[model samples]
Target: MSWFKQGLCFLPVFLVIWSSSTFIVTYLIALFRHDVDIIFPYISDTGANPPESCIFGLMTFISACAGTATIYARYKYVEKLSEDPKVVNPRLNKTAFLFGMLSCLGMCIVATFQETTVTVIHDIGALLFFVTGVLYIILQSVLSHRAYPFGSSMFVCRVRSGVAILAFLAFFPTVICAFFVTQTTLHRDKGDTDYPYHIASAVCEWIVAFSFICFFLTYIDDFKIFTLRVRVECKE
Candidate 1:
């Protein structure tokens, strides 16, 4: 592959790793803060916190770039795999990739509208990120059943796909339960947060984030055959 193609191939990969890492790091730092309760506060709350907010918001923007790159890579990878035309649907891959892009866009929006600063936009972004992202997961799960032009491990694909599907399937009920329970606490008690509901939502959000990361990790195996390497000799 040319240098440009090589860059394209790895852009999403690197961005994903960085974004995921930054998210974890920011959360860890925010967890120690006295104002926020690690167990119940949403991930977005971390982004709302003063100092850590910068890091979380930056990571979210990076995630959007990663998503754009992923969309490009997905199209190219699927196109390459579909050259034979006899097996596989390029269209399906394209659709999944589009969904992934929208998911990323949602993250960007959430970052732009931090929870404390603007709850409505942030909530909209959260819903968009989760719902469309899960749809992408489901589409990719279906695609895994088909054969790739380049070699693919059915076992790995199946397992990853299954996990994505199951986690996504669980996200809905988990969020709904959390919402109702949390709302009751907010309205009935007025001051006390429903720890159970808050904790549940936070957990579900983490699971969904994990699933998103895992789906992208599968790309590492797929990109294994494609490499960008440079050799340098010192003084010899």
Candidate 2:
């Protein structure tokens, strides 16, 4: 295979690095500026200020684009395996694609709307991203299990399943704790009454985000073997 063709495998790798770097960079910026406290802050909190917010928005937008492409490529990969015309898996694969796109769209919304300024909309976007993102992974795991012989390895399937389970386990605590805490500003001081709840939610948020990133890393090997192509034909 051509180098460029094999490069598709790097999409997930790029996403994992890019998105994680976004969070780390923004957190460091916020920390250095003393805009946020030393304790854990929501991922959005790290990017709620001026310069960091701008960087957060731009990097997150890039992440969304990369994520969209990765999801679509995985969808096409499954469609290729469902070569049997009678197989009903294509419909399920399409559903997974829709969920993945919606998750990416949510990331776009989060990137565009700063949590401190438009908290409701930002929270909505976060909710959409987390909820739909989890659903997308669960569906893909199912498809991976079904496509065992034709596509993914048993090891990859099991790994994806494990990640999906971890993401699901983290999802509820993130949401529940977030509700218990009240958002007054971008940063939360340890002295705040809701500090415990805030920390819990923040930690869980990080877990879910990293889980999503880790799940994508499994795609590298799968993408290495397949070459996606476009065919053109003239009909008389």
Candidate 3:
């Protein structure tokens, strides 16, 4: 099949796997909260629950699948270009492959290390993974422009760049909130300062929510560009 057709086939499959894995992990988190209520009646009153293990498991699985897809897509694109010799730039293809591989490895490490037992290590790992993942996506966006400047350039590029900047801006507040929350949790042996911790935690929550929204918007833009290419090709 043509490059356009191959892209079309991969696009929906990637979205389905990506979206479903995220949804399942989120769903499991909610389920875990309900289960916590049964274990300790006072826990609901305190409104404190441990992070769900299921989310981490789901994240690992999703990252693996995504990593495989990234490697495969890069290889396939390179192979296609090699066959035709005039189809696409080999250097751009190699860049995509390299970044994709890095993203996969980063996610795997982040997911493996994100545990409540090692809160500091987990947070640091998460921060590293988050930065790397964002960078990888940004690199892909840049490379897409290099490959097909006019055809790939779309509104999504602006949206993603803006969102990524916003995420960076919010990072400080999130880190500060995390610090206060950690301190409060550590003082648990002394007394309960849940209220202050709750406020700080809420801020962190908002930052995370914003980050996810930004990521989704970026992916949506990617899908739009992929679809446009397929449609344009079909018309010709």
Candidate 4:
């Protein structure tokens, strides 16, 4: 019933929406570049099963809905914050918001071009996305620690810290893998498949997968416990 509770309810919805948008945009880029066939078995053989355009378009729609939900949640959360008496760091929050927005923009631009043309701009955008992701992760780590009361919940603290560290470790491998994979795939037309490159690619793939698992497990556990607590508290 309180504004804080309302805002909390919206946080997950917002994250989901934001994540979906990124996924949709990425899907579109994959479709446009005709790389869909290489990555997807359903469409790899004939390039017909998923229907590049259709799949991307559907993903775009889904992403749009998610973006809308995120906007709604953010607006509500901001409104709730306005009622607080604490001095808000407008500068930091503004910087974070801008960084996040630019990151999304860069991601969308990169996705749009990943299919149509091979340009340095796309690469730059990809790099920007990587940098932005790192910044966001760091910001989140700091914010999470600042928000939670120290010593009030040791279990939660350890869990959060462990997740942060794992996520940080995962980022490096994933980013490196993404860069190498993009470069290698781009140069595939030139027929340059050295043994080390292949090995690097394989290692990168494994690292990326491991990093994703760490990230997913971290959030999944957090949310699962949070939801369980909510249910228990409600029943009581």
Q: Name the candidate that leads on TM-score.
A: 2
Pairs in clash, predicted candidate 1: none
User: Against the true structure, candidate 1 has what lDDT?
Assistant: 0.71
What TM-score, computed on C-alpha atoms, does each candidate reach? 0.81, 0.92, 0.55, 0.51
> Global CA lDDT of candidate 3, please?
0.47
Predicted candidate 3 versus true structure: per-residue lDDT over 1-236, tens digit per residue: 35325433455346445645553444455455653222112111122223545465455557556655645554464345345445456666666566556555655554555344554565565565555555555555554444443333566556556665666665565556546544323113224454455454445544543454345434433333332222344554
Error of 4 at 177 (Å): 6.0
Q: List ranges where model 4 is wrong by over 4 Å.
A: 1-50, 53-90, 150-164, 173-236
lDDT of 2 by residue, 88-173 (tens): 38999999999999999999999999988898999999999999999999999999888877777899899999999999999999
Candidate 1 residues 1-236, lDDT tens each?
45335434466467668878866777777777653555545677666777888888887888788777765666566667777666668788788888888888898998788787887898899888888889987877777667543545887678768778767776886578566553521112325556566666667877777777777767655654554345898995
Once model 3 is optimally superposed onto the true structure by TM-score, how far is the C-alpha of residue 94 displaced, in angstroms?
6.0
**Model 2, poorest ten-residue lDDT window?**
1-10
By the lDDT metric, which is better: model 1 or model 3?
A: 1
Predicted structure with the largest lDDT when compared to the true one: 2
Estimate every model's Cα lDDT from 0 to 1.
0.71, 0.89, 0.47, 0.42
